[model samples]
Target: MPGSLSAYLSQVEEDGADYVVIDTPPHAGGTIDAAIRAADLVVIPIRPGPFDINAAAGTVGIMKQTGRPGIFVLSQVAAVGPEGDDTAAVLQELYPDVPVAKARLGQRKAFMQALISGQAITEFDRPSSKAVGEIKALFREVRSRL
Candidate 1:
């Protein structure tokens, strides 16, 4: 873990990166533990589902235990539906101390296509894609806290 953390931080520092985003696995592991310890802020992306919500709780617990600040970003949300709101509310209620991002990412084909095409959503096709906007907004929300 030290080797991994050193390599990861060295690159970010050497490259003069403003932010380093680490995507942890669904379940708890050594990598996640190291990340939470090394992170300035943790971003937990949760889907509006029973399993996801349950998993997020465990992640949030790790954050709290480590005395690390974290935020929840509701991912793959419906564009116009009650599920997003209801899920956010439930999450907030469950973890009152953790902050949830107002900028939610809706389920979009552009996101999947961007991965398949090996390109960013902003670079995939249309510059005016809502997926791009959503990501930018999420970045802003995360950056503002830092």
Candidate 2:
């Protein structure tokens, strides 16, 4: 994010690119504004926790003002029990137009293990508890929106 991502995005579109993804650090700034200006959609990742869900709302507001769609990905959720309902209710209350699908990335030790070893979950161990299944499902939803 050296300058406005919008500047780069403008250049890419001029060159006939279909899409561009710009990852900025977890903060709001000139770079974020630029990226928002350039994007058709914004994807905000929120852990299934109160604080994280609140943060996702702020991001969605930015996208709304910028005339871009903002999607939420709930991560680090408990695999079972009442926690899912709590998180889902919070999201449903906020951005009902954007579908918060039932699929999620649960909290798991294997994810941390893979990250520590500098490998993707699929590349490190596809068969370990099958979190890839969840990731794949999430990707499909995202793809359909795009």
Candidate 3:
């Protein structure tokens, strides 16, 4: 599987693809390792909770093993609360090597609504919507890292 993934990623690069985003499950395994090996930068999403923060260690360990850089993006964060900030602080304290993204994806109906409507938040919601802005900010952060 790793060989296949490497081959596919090579083809994607040769085909002039600007980027190939690969989403993997939280647990560690061959596929996850292979994806990490193939990735230039890994984006680890963490919800605002202790369990979620602890679970991220495995992926962070894999990234370390492969000597690849990664950034943590807080997802499904509460719209009004310190949970998001506190979680980010804990993550930074625990894994000082990995940076946390400045943009937090707040828990919003638009995300689910867009999925149900088979459209992205950028398309499903108005441009000025918070969800749309959050998505755009995340894109910028990820792009800057790449």
Candidate 4:
């Protein structure tokens, strides 16, 4: 099982896949290790809360150990509040080497609706919707980093 993920990723690459996004659970394990090893850029999603911020340290540690660059994207952030900014500041202060993304996914119904419909927010929501904008901006930032 240790090398299974790597082998699968290798096959995906062989099949001309442009990118492979592996969403691992918020815990330490062989699967997470393998995913980190195979990643070109690890995108860590952190919610604006004390527990989420603290939990992210483990993933950050893994990234450092693997020497893989990563960015922290704020997820499910409130539309109007200081929590998002405060969290970003804390993340930057705690991990000066890693960058916190400017684009944040806000807490909106569109995201849940998209999930229920098995579609992305860009596809499920109106083009001019804020949720769509947030996703697009995040994609652009992630693309630039890659």
Worst 10 residues of 1 by lDDT: 21-30
The residue pairs that clash in candidate 3, if any, are: none
What is candidate 3's lDDT per residue for 1-146, written digit by digit as tens? 77888889889989999989988888848989999988889999999999999999899999999999999999999989899999999999999999999998999999999999999899899999999999999999999998
What is the lDDT for 36 in model 3?
91
Compared with the true structure, the alpha-carbon lDDT of candidate 2 equals 0.74
Stretches of model 3 off by over 4 angstroms after superposition: none
How well is each residue in 56-83 modelled by candidate 1, as lDDT tens digits? 8777888889999988899999878788
How do the residues 59-104 of candidate 4 rate in per-residue lDDT, one tens digit apiece?
8899999999999999999989899999999999999999999999
Q: Estimate each model's TM-score.
A: 0.93, 0.80, 0.94, 0.95
lDDT of each: 0.86, 0.74, 0.93, 0.91
Where model 1 places Cα greater than 4 Å from the true spot, the runs are none
Instruction: Tell me the lDDT of model 4 at 60.
Output: 88
RMSD of each: 1.3, 2.8, 1.3, 1.1
Model 4 vs truth, CA RMSD: 1.1
How far off is residue 6 in model 4, in Å?
A: 1.5
Weakest ten-residue segment in model 4 by summed lDDT: 1-10
User: By lDDT, highest first, what's the ranking?
Assistant: 3, 4, 1, 2
Cα deviation of 7, candidate 3, in Å: 2.7
Error of 4 at 101 (Å): 0.4
On lDDT, the leading prediction is: 3
Q: Candidate 4: where are CA atoms >4 Å away?
A: none
Q: What TM-score, to 2 decimals, does candidate 1 have?
A: 0.93
Task: Score candidate 3 by TM-score against the native.
Answer: 0.94
For TM-score, the strongest prediction is 4
